[model samples]
Target: MKLDRTAIEALLPHRAPILLPTEVEADPATRSGRALIRLDANARIFGALAQPALAHELLLEAAAQTFGIVIGACPPEGGAAAGAEGRHLLLGFDEVEFGPAALDGGAPFELEVALEQTSGPVHVARFSAEQGGAQVARGQLQVFNG
Candidate 1:
């Protein structure tokens, strides 16, 4: 499923100044998705610097939120939606690496995430981030969707 910004707002509990993922191409069945975050010089996370850039750590946030989309959009077997109202939390990261942004000055950041494993409320996912088609970060994330 593809989600535009407005649909994202309805499903995600985030607003500007911190909202990531301007768009999403998510599939619960596939347990994977692409999340895109586009920024301009005036974007809040980067402050008022002449050129804006999202800090490396925030890329992890994008991964987490994108992962949430997959987990949250699924229909529960006999209950509420897997993507139902719940707390999505970051638990840990592994083999994560960061490289310099390919496009500076607040360009678009895209994250491709695939769910790796899950046990009850805990989930593991691997993600890679790219800007201008160049990888900026890659890692595995452990999260809690409780």
Candidate 2:
């Protein structure tokens, strides 16, 4: 399924500034997804730090939101409205690597996320981000759904 900003807003709890991706494509059956984020000077991250590079925390949040979209699109059996009523928590991160900084120049970036495993309300996903054909970051996110 393809999700726009409105759909993303409906699915995610995050609002403007914090909300990252402009669009997303998710395959619920395969539990895989991709998202596109365009960062510009107006982005909150830029305003907060006034740095030329996108912060690592923002990248991580973007990955998390992308995964959230995937899960939101595919609600489990008897699960509530995806993330509507559920609480998604970041359990931890594994083997996270931050590559070259992403400059705030209205450049677009892509994020890919794949489900690694699921145990109860906990879901593990591998994610990576790329900008200008170069890797920006990668990590495994352990998320808990409740």
Candidate 3:
């Protein structure tokens, strides 16, 4: 069965994480689907201004547990949504840490996080945060499906 945006959203447990549609236009010349997603690392939407630690929580090693949210987007038409059904494997945070926030800066701080496909019981991925091209914090998370 194919999954649409609504169905996918329902399956996802993360309530407020930012979600960006991963879509590509079909090529008229070759008539290819062009559905494969080429995500620009800079396009990710950070947590809202309402919550201060929300964004930081995503970068923490324990973030997957601290806050719930899905990490990646399925194909344009939609593929098997990535997430768990009930619980996830925990990747405790130890060395990851975010720098202090600036009062005048637009973004509290910029972060670079990555999620990799895993075959474990939990949804696992790698994450990092940086400022002025300097690595400020980094960690891994295991998002629960339920």
Candidate 4:
């Protein structure tokens, strides 16, 4: 299920997308997605995603997971028609991190991501996951015209 540039563009809002390198870490659960890494002004890189650690064959997997998602043509305005103004496009992984066992007490873990339109000018967007009243994880992805 490798999506080429055309397929990705058709599925996303922006004509082009900034596909970062695929990163994966060992987890007890089988959930899978990419890890977002960021660097500060002092040139220190930080992991935006969080994963639980276990003692096993420590290894990092490098591949796109089955959890990535892309949504185009967002819902319309409040109680309005389908073809309303200001549509939204979203792209990110649904579940990221995996192994043979579930995360802490069978609860799903969340990862953070950042997206941007970075060709000439860099415009950014951020996303976070929440359940009930607690925050879970976050992610980001970039889109552009083809």
The lDDT values for all models are 0.74, 0.79, 0.37, 0.28
Off by over 4 Å in 3: 1-72, 75-94, 99-105
Residue 59, candidate 3: how far off, in angstroms?
5.5
lDDT of 3 by residue, 51-134 (tens): 233434433422332222233233212334343234444545445555564322233333333345445444555555454555
Error of 4 at 127 (Å): 0.6
Q: Candidate 1 regions off by >4 Å? A: 14-16, 41-43, 46-54, 76-82, 100-105
Q: Rank the candidates by TM-score, best first.
A: 2, 1, 3, 4
lDDT of 4 by residue, 1-146 (tens): 23343443344323222332222222212212233311111111133223234211011110121122221222222444322433332232333333443334223223332332334322233444322234443444333222
Backbone clashes in model 3, listed as residue pairs: 84-145, 85-146
lDDT of 1 by residue, 45-99 (tens): 5456322344665677778777876666655346576666486788988999987
Off by over 4 Å in 2: 45-54, 77-85, 101-105
TM-score of each: 0.82, 0.83, 0.39, 0.23
**Residue runs of model 4 more than 4 Å from their true location after superposition:** 1-71, 74-123
Give the Cα error of residue 43 in candidate 4, in Å.
36
Worst 10 residues of 1 by lDDT: 45-54
lDDT of 2: 0.79
Best by the TM-score measure: 2
Worst 10 residues of 4 by lDDT: 55-64
Best by lDDT: 2
